[model samples]
Target: MNLSILYRGPLSSCNYACPYCPFAKRRETPAELAYDRRCLERFVSWVATRTGDSIGVLFTPWGEALIRKWYQSALVTLSSLPHVRKAAIQTNLSCQLDWVDACDKAKLALWCTFHPGETSRERFLAQCRVLLQRGVRFSVGVVGLKEHLAEIEALRRELPAEVYLWVNAYKRQREYYTPEMIADLTRIDPLFPLNNTFHASRGHSCRAGASVIAVDGEGTIRRCHFIPTPIGNIYDPNFADSLYERPCTNDTCGCHIGYVHLDRLKLYDTFGDGVLERIPYGFGESKPFLENLSHAHLSTE
Candidate 1:
């Protein structure tokens, strides 16, 4: 069976200082960094041994991971593995683009986030252009802060139409956006309303433990990131026996990575093979899937 692993290591430091993010500008000591590196190497080595199963990995670190050299090497290593279907990561696009040249473009994808104040728009766009020129599969997104609405709109316009630009709803405050504001963002990103709502996920069927899972630095595996209960460990020999369909135990799942896997949402049909990388099927084409949004049956409470 094909398995999708959302791997988050112990690396929790970032160079950008986004006000809303807890990990912003956080610094890790040399010892901590070394430990994180070892954890990541162990995870990658474990992935390499899973030749009998098709594996797809997405590194969802607390801080920006692409900025580190080890992450770059890991992606390069994972992308070349014949058993690895895809190797992607959540990055801030702060790292140099040269490393991607060594990766197998077919299996290497990136989920890039654009922070307005952290970097200049021109610089970010330039990096995107490089990715485009390199034929790298990627998706760009930004937090839907009211203050950054103008920047978000400008980014959508400036980016290539083929490149999907997504907006992540800023839900830190209650009713943070007005109806008009939602409409404006919706026009830019047809999927905005979906991200804007908090999904009630308790007792809901999800594919987390069965086909997808979240793995921490120590190889502890959980159904998903929102749930802390350990279902198994990736290093355990009989770990495959523990995977099965399970209901979400959390009252709410607001994060895209968590809620997208809810069976009731039918997002798997929406994203198809691109779910791990956050790319919608036929995104740049005619986008025939957009016509089926009404049928997704997502419950937003």
Candidate 2:
């Protein structure tokens, strides 16, 4: 069976001092660098061993990963493989874009978040233009703070229509978004309503263990990012044992990567095979997503 791996190890170091994030404005040490390399090597080798199945990898780092040279090498190497359908990462768009030209355009993607104070909009848009010229798939996003309202609108205007722009709801102040505020953001991010809040998923069926998984630098496999308890190790001989149906221990699910896998949300069908590279959102002249919601509602009744 094909699988999606959310690799999130080698985390907690970042180049920008975003006030909201804990892992900000730090650099990796020599020891940290070595550890990251070794873990990636093991992961690459593990992928080589999985000849029977195709895999998609998303490097969900807490820090800025594109700044690291080894990550560039790994992404290049992974994208070249035939069995790897997708090898993408979440980045702050602070790194150079010339290196991205070497990776497989069809399989490589980026989930980029725009930090207002850390980098100017000009620099950010320049990198995005490079991706577009290279035919690389990516989605741009920002934390939906009221202060960023103008910047968000400007971003939508500058970016091409094919490139999807997303809005990340500020978790701390979600309750503060009045009907008017949500209406405003929804104009910027078509799927803002779904993304602006958490979904109650205590007993819903999900694709977490069956195919989607969150892996750490140490190869520890959790059902998904939200749950940190170890289900198994990827290197174990019988690591497949870890895959099973399990209920979410938490009541609410946020975060795009985590929230997308909730089966009850019907995102699995909405995104189809493009969930790793694209977000399913369209506010104007696009109502299929909303239509899907209604279809999903009738199916259960």
Candidate 3:
């Protein structure tokens, strides 16, 4: 079976202090960092044993992970595994880039996010250029805050046309984005409209527990991060038996990581093998895919 795992460890610390995030500027104690390291090592070891299944891993840490040496080492190690199809992470791109050269570029990808005020656009773009030079597959994105619209548009203009730039809508407040603002952002990212909607997902068929799972540092597994009920632990011998098609229990899912798995959305067709990295299939190709956006059936509760 081809299994996709979103692993989040206990390392909740970041270098930047973005106003919108709770974890902003939070630092972990030495003991806490050591605990996170141990958990990650155990998870990586567990992944190495899953030779019977084709595995893809995305490190969806609460804080920035790439800044830590352990995460970088883990990516390099995981990418080299023959059974691992892809090893990627959601990162702020604030770390050094030389380590990427040690990884198997074909199996390694990155989901890079740009914070407008936290990091200058030029610095982030330079990092992206290094990744491009290294032949790494990645997608760049920004949180769709109204204040950052100008920076977002400028980023789209400066980035290579082949690179896919995505936008995550700010949904903290109701009606956060005006229709005209949405339209402007949508023009830059055709997929922005989908991200802006709070998808009504309760009782909807989703691929979460079956083929895709959210795993924590302790190996506890759930349908996804938004759901708290644990189906099983990854360390359990019978864990594979617990995985099966399950409907979402939440009223709505706004996060891309959670909503993209809704079978009705058919996002797998939109993303193809790049689902974990958040890159659309046929991205950077002709604009024909934009015409089929309605087929995703985006809706809210």
How big is the RMSD of model 1?
A: 1.1
Residue 127, candidate 2: alpha-carbon lDDT: 88
**Which of the predicted structures, 2 or 3, would earn the higher TM-score when compared with the native?**
3
What C-alpha lDDT do the candidate models reach, one value each? 0.91, 0.81, 0.92
Write candidate 3's Cα lDDT for 192-284 as tens digits.
989988888999999999999999999999999999999999999899999999778998888889888998888887887888999887787
* Candidate 2 global CA lDDT score: 0.81
Error of 1 at 242 (Å): 1.6
User: What TM-score quantifies how close candidate 3 is to the native fold?
Assistant: 0.97
- lDDT for each residue of candidate 1 in 50-169, tens digit (9 for 90 to 100): 999999999999999898999999999999999999999999999999999999999999999999999999999999999999999999999999999999999999999878788999
* Clash tally, candidates in order: 0, 0, 0
RMSD of candidates 1 onward, in order = 1.1, 2.7, 1.2
What would the TM-scores of all predictions be? 0.97, 0.93, 0.97
Any residue pairs clashing in model 2, and if so which? none
Question: What pairs collide in candidate 1?
Answer: none
